[model samples]
Target: MGNMDISLKEMMAIDGAVGAAVVDYNSGMALGVVGGSKDLDLQVAAAGNTEVVRAKMRTMESLGIKDGIEDILITLTNQYHLIRPVSGRGGKGLFLYLALDRNRANLALARHNLRGTEEKLEI
Candidate 1:
């Protein structure tokens, strides 16, 4: 069972990771954050992404899609934003957000690592 600190630390270790946060989507609050610079504000990212998650969930429900979201990826000109909702009982309504430098990050590897981290996370 991994704690938030460990989970966040692991996230930051990912190649090209610039910032990471564990957020409570229900309240749009960040439980923990790490690795943000002057240009990257994790708190703002957390709050803004909460709406993204909610909107997607709503859309899925409205469309009668029963599948759960594994993750959401947003690509920018220079970066990649990844949002992964926690699936464990202890982490309900929580998510892990990661921002990566597109040039340095291997998207497939990052996604795989995030999934492993989530599986071991204990909120």
Candidate 2:
């Protein structure tokens, strides 16, 4: 398995990958990040998105569904924000957050690649 740096770098190489981050949901902090626009602060975005993840998890628990989240998608007018919680052993409490330009990205492929990255990412 690859470490955090290699996993995140590979994600950044995808087409339309404007930015990516490995964040700790429990703390709302970015453990590693790549690419960011002056208008888009990766850290701030990560912090805000942590709330989204938490809220969803809370809602799921309230429903009594035992399944875990595979991914969460937020589509905007111009961009797609993808939030995927890491799974498997020792992957709890972490997620891979990726932002893409909708016009340039293939969401299906990005989802596949992100799943691979999630398997490799170490913490």
Candidate 3:
């Protein structure tokens, strides 16, 4: 079982990974993070992304969809941002935030890898 540290470490192993964080959407806080760029503050990114997650969740509720989120992907010109909520009961209210260079990363593979990582994550 992996905790926040272990999960964050695994996220850093993704290709072209610039940074990764374990964030609490309910509180807009990063419980753990690693390998962030100085130009892009991971803490701020994590907190801001919390709103994205919440908005999507709220929309889902409004639409009357009962299923949980698997992940959220935001693709930009140069970067790919991935937000994946933890699935287990132990990881309630938290998510994994990852950023990668679009040119250097494979989005599909990264998604698959992150899913694997989340499944084993203890926290």
Model 1, position 31: C-alpha lDDT score = 95
> Cα lDDT for residue 88, model 1?
93
Instruction: Give lDDT for model 1.
Output: 0.96
Give the worst 10-residue stretch by lDDT in candidate 1: 1-10
Best by TM-score: 1
The lDDT values for all models are 0.96, 0.91, 0.91
Every model's TM-score:
0.97, 0.96, 0.95
- Give me the overall lDDT of model 2: 0.91
- Give the Cα-based TM-score of candidate 1 against the true structure: 0.97
Please give the distance, in angstroms, between residue 93's alpha carbon in candidate 3 and its true position after superposition: 0.5
**Candidate 1, position 2, lDDT:** 43
Clashing pairs in 2: none
Off by over 4 Å in 3: none
Superior by TM-score: candidate 2 or candidate 3? 2
Local accuracy of candidate 1 as per-residue lDDT tens digits, 1-123: 348999999999999999999999999999999999899899999999999999999999999999989999999999999999999999999999999999999999999999998999896
Q: For all the candidates, what are their Cα RMSDs to the real structure? A: 1.3, 1.5, 1.5
